[model samples]
Target: MFFAVFLHVLAFAFLVVGRTLAPRNVPLLRRAVGDNSTSSGIASLALDKSSGSYYTVLKAGDSYFRVALDTGSSDLWLISSACTSSQCSKVPKYPLAYKSSTFQAVNNNQTEFSASYGDGTGVSGFVAREMVTVANITLKDQAVGVIDSSNVTLDSDVSGLLGLGFPRLSSMSESVTNSSPFFSQLAQQGKLEYPLFGLSLNRFDNGSLTLGAVDASVVRDVNQISWHPVVEFSPFGMESQESSYLQWVTPLAGFGTNGTTLSPNPSYPEITNNASLALLDVGLNGIYGPYSDVSRLFEAMDGARLVDSEGGLWAVPCDTKQNMTFTFGEQTIVLQPSDYFLGRTSGSPNLCISWPAAQSPSADGVDWHIGTPFLRTVYSVYSYGINNVEAPVIGFYPVTNSTTAQADEENLSSILTTVKFTPPNSLLATPTDTILPYTFNASVAAPTTGLVSTGLATSTYSPIFQAWTTVRSAIPTIAPSYAVFTDSSGAVVTSTPSIAAVTLGSPPGWTGPNGAGRSSPAPIVVTVAILFAALGQWIFCFIV
Candidate 1:
């Protein structure tokens, strides 16, 4: 009888395991082949270590790590170590109540969540209540989501993240039972003015997030600036109900010599509507979207080229002219030469810089992205309070003399150069054993149909694991040359090596620094512009 019982148990285990292991393919893998079909959430934030320009932030618990905010996603999450659930254990985790006297968890039940990465990395974790604070606002007994894992590799130094965009791309909608995000809570309390908040991301070197009130010092006169109403939406479309996203008109008055790029021809050649709220963004990186008119404006004036990322193709160029200007509503502001910034890429061109462009998709007429690529041009402000209503609107102003723009790039270069990369221990050809112990009596098998299951399951896995061996085994890329500012006369002053100059397999036609000289006899010419608040309905940014 004992022998028979043992044999039966073995057969049951095989039956369960066979069902799950025998599925020919995974649905997540199939969906991943598409261009925009991805689960890795893109987000943005301000880098505190060096430049103040807002980038992206990633989150795990009570902690919020800065990352690149993205409009391409609909969910929000942070990597954490505290989350022991199989889902979250792969990424870094932060202890919810570690150091906060104000920390209190309204709910502490361990829940599982799964999210995909840009390189096809995915992790699952447990969710619970966490005490969190943003700026000076402390959230007590806040229902927080937690992921407890450290198996996934990170692209940069973001500890966690805060997602401040739209609701349609929210993780709360998927896993949490009864919880509202921080921004929504602020709106409920009527803590903001104009029922909105504004964002002002200065050039990458000198940017800062202006929440609630205007800095006043940066602008000529705050009272002279005209305010407008924010747009509203339901789900993915415009709705009858008032929206929480701040919408305002761009006042073009104070911009310097170059004048408003949108054109003053009364026809708004570049912009079909100046009343559009494309610039309203609080936690985003900078102005992003497909604006053909704006693209032509920059192409004609600054000589920028269009580029692409997960967000979409934006403008990128080798060099820029100084003293650029933009006007909003009744207010006009001018940006000096230094406000423009540059970027580097791992793919094609080793060095990628920001440029202005206008593009629209077939489904959406006017799609604008306020990302870091655009934010680095000016100082930004956000007022969570407006019209006795507490929504958020983004406001912009020029940034000067601050090291905000240069800092993020310099720091990013430093982090990448300094950190050492390590490969995972095991490389499996097919699906390997589960990292976490299986609790069910039978192995969970993959379904014959529908790659769609809401709950976190063993079947949900990242495809990046296949490439781990290839990437880890290869040698790191190195830059070949350095960039040195130069004058028309070709004299050198100061020089810095280019990251691309050292790395291999980087973008082609890599030019070290311009050979003219180490320094430009001309002063570092710059311009500064501002962008405002982003919507609370979507994922805002990502950590690099």
Candidate 2:
């Protein structure tokens, strides 16, 4: 009896140690793919073309909600059942207090939470702690915002947003309770094997979001991934006093069209090598950059001209074949014409709006906002670094080849041929309206503030503005203009018009029609140890 009890105790010890030491591998799932249909236990990402967003499933309490994946901001918020706002009514909401047994309001729901985005959308609510699960890994008592009010423009398909940015960017961190973001919570709880996550966003098919470690299957060549150190300062500029990095800002080595590089704006001389700073944001659908640089970028393309000087909207010939290149470190990622073209305007089927929109430095001090147009070209990995032991880095691996780009270009050309539009002989001259350069005032000790444009049509006489308004009227399902800004006071402001719907072609530099193939995850060491321990108990029983 004594020997048998001793053997049982020994087996239990081995099981406990094995389970604790084993790595946790969680898979992100595409919304189109069923929740139970993860491929080899790897997360799959899905793109919603209507909203121009990518999202994944997140489970809170007993219910699951689809949340948009945003790396630009740092906060995980969901509309609550208590919310009666029209925007909140459109999407799925978190369960009521009694509905979920695990839901607990922090500070008796007195602590307020608020955050905003570059696109002029914002959310405000109370803080709560609940068991949140992504892929299969669960973070117990994760702090999340129970949004009671919001001006965020969300489609019916997505419940809310899951921000994968740093802790300093989190509004919850600045709240009374001072809670960390969801990803940071996972690390603090020792749930991740590695302190990073990988994202694979595809235009044609399903993509993936791998937590803890890189997904070997999606990467064509791991060794080729060019990793860059994350910029330490706030991408929004020196206005804020946050002492840590906010967004996934990285160094942009070069940018040009058809091998001709554009000169960087001389106003910001702090950047090295005339290179601009780029924020890799998955939430934003298109690219935004300094007004001067963007103006030069469009000038290089045939029949391209600034359509709206104040709004920074540009138009180009639908049939233009210009190729743009963005260099980062030693890696140069190229984008074919099909990738940058948004689509033909409703009023003018021949004219197309360029995706690389221009923004004044006063609006957003960041030199560049690299969105899906650039991200879809390669596989991206974001490393948070292990508790300050390592520095945060953003790595990119090329998945698309020249052959794939050629095929995509041909496909776009075929579509454009059906629409009749005349090409301009020379580049149209820009408007005479002057846009002033951004200047930092060191005398005033205040947080950074700037006008966040809605990037939608306003009351303007420009033909492009009329065309944009016509398109918005044609699409009745599109949300109305709503501007929510996050400044020093955290005020929610209203704006007019949102982006008009555009026809989506194959994204610029996709690997193939179906994207990369999947591979089985490697065996865990803990599983092997457990099996060995169980076998030993059986052998000892037989010997006795």
How many clashes in each structure?
189, 9
Residue pairs that clash (backbone atoms under 3 angstroms), model 2? 27-43, 28-43, 28-44, 30-44, 45-207, 120-484, 239-448, 481-497, 483-495
**lDDT value for model 1:** 0.32
Please provide, for model 1 over 1-544, each residue's C-alpha lDDT reduced to its tens digit, 9 standing for 90 to 100.
0001001111111101000011010000001112432111111123322212233322222233433333333333455445455433322235443433543343344556565542234546655555454433444544454555533433223333344444434566446654445544444343322122334443222222222234333454453333322333212333222222312223222222344345432222122233233433333333433443344445554534444322223333323344445455544444332333333344433233433323332121123434443444444443332222122233455444332223343333432211111212233122111123221121222111112212111222221112122121111111112245665667653322211111111112323221111110122222111122221011112122
List per-prediction Cα lDDT, in the order shown. Answer: 0.32, 0.56
- For residue 21, give model 2's deviation from the true position in Å: 40
lDDT of 1 at 173: 46
Candidate 2 residues 1-544, lDDT tens each?
0001001121111101000011112233322122432111245555554334567666787655667787887788887767778876666566563346788778899899876644345678899898888866677778898888876656533567788888767778777353778876665444554456777875532467776556665564455666776765423344454334556877777777867866566334443234466888887666777777788787788777766555466777666667887877777888766666665544465577666767654322357778776788788988664332344678788766642235243455443322222234355455432334433332332221111121111212122112112221211011112234543566444432122221111112323432121212232112222333432110000110
- Which portions of model 2 show Cα errors greater than 4 Å? 1-41, 97-99, 117-120, 176-178, 234-242, 271-275, 346-350, 362-364, 403-410, 413-544
lDDT, residue 5, model 2 = 9
Highest-scoring model, TM-score: 2
